[model samples]
Target: MEGADWLRTRLTSLHCATCGRSYRDGQIRVRAQRDGLSFVDFVCRACGREANAIVTVVGRGRAARLEVGELAESPPGARSPSLGPADVLAMRRFLRRFNGDFRSLFGADGRAGGRLGA
Candidate 1:
């Protein structure tokens, strides 16, 4: 998490996979991360099942900023940054509602189509 403070700001909520308890920053442990993605693990204080995430940044601004906080870049077109803070906020909202399914999330109108589905 040396260079992932900006990412920390965006991930405002995390849910436990074991007992469905909401997670806090102090409970999260960063396993690894790159420019636009991160692999993290957190233990559920309620039931002890570890929760993991491969956090992806597709929003805007710092999501496109270099890992070291604007220290360098690969030229303009090389990176495709989104519009603005609104985009980032939208993505955060999406992640907060993530149900851990790709088909339900992207296969049909990008939504959960049924009860107990993502």
Candidate 2:
């Protein structure tokens, strides 16, 4: 497997420090990589908390060595990109207009592929 894929597997096995929830593969995003260093973001779906980390992978193939460091943890009871009253109101309006039918909401013509806000 590629170095990033291997690193993601390792991260997926770990739980979020704030929420204690196992991270899904989709929640682990590799933002950038160069040489032996990689920047990764781990976003917890349950609590909407994000943690930034740096991973180092040296060598290649089976002999590759992996190390992780410089993890930026959020302060206790802190949430990044805090939401405002306007955001809550906007969400309330959307939810009020939203029905349970996601297929129709996202356009069953396959343009949106069932993703919200597509």
Candidate 3:
């Protein structure tokens, strides 16, 4: 199954961080995908506000770790193309070449270190 579909199957329910509106599995929608993660964003059916979800499955198959985090805002609009396997490999390559420059990796706000913008 695709990342989003897998996450949907795994999740029982979710709620909007901004509005406290509850969401069943079918209410969420994928806005982005990278690696074993899916970024889902939608207008809350209850409060009519935007909500974001970062659903990730680490490892593979049955041993994977499924994580879901609420985002204050939707993810950044597509900066480039949709993520793919090749993009993940390229990211791994980039990180491998990283010289541990914290500022360069995370930018001035250190937002890139986590889900700050989204």
Task: Give the TM-score of each candidate.
Answer: 0.43, 0.54, 0.48
| lDDT of each residue in 52-110, candidate 3, tens digit only | 66887777878877677756564545223578999999989988987777775666678
What value of lDDT does candidate 1 attain over all alpha carbons?
A: 0.57
Q: Candidate 2: global Cα-lDDT? A: 0.78
Runs of candidate 3 exceeding 4 Å displacement:
74-118
For model 2, state the Cα shift of residue 79 in Å: 12
Q: Give one digit per residue, the lDDT tens place, for model 1 in 1-118.
A: 2346655544436565446677666666665777666765565567656545667656576445322221121233432355899998998998899878776555565555544343
Maximum-TM-score candidate: 2
Cα lDDT listed for each candidate: 0.57, 0.78, 0.68
Kindly report which residue pairs in candidate 1 clash with one another. Answer: none
Better of 1 and 2 by lDDT: 2
Badly placed stretches (over 4 Å) of model 1 are 1-3, 62-118
Residue-wise lDDT of candidate 2 within 68-104, one digit each (tens)?
7756874545544679999999999989987788786
Q: Mind sharing the TM-score for model 3?
A: 0.48
Model 2: lDDT of residue 104: 68
Candidate ordering by TM-score (highest first): 2, 3, 1
| Clashes (candidate 3) | 0
lDDT of 3 at 87: 91
Q: Give residue 91's error in model 3 in angstroms.
A: 39
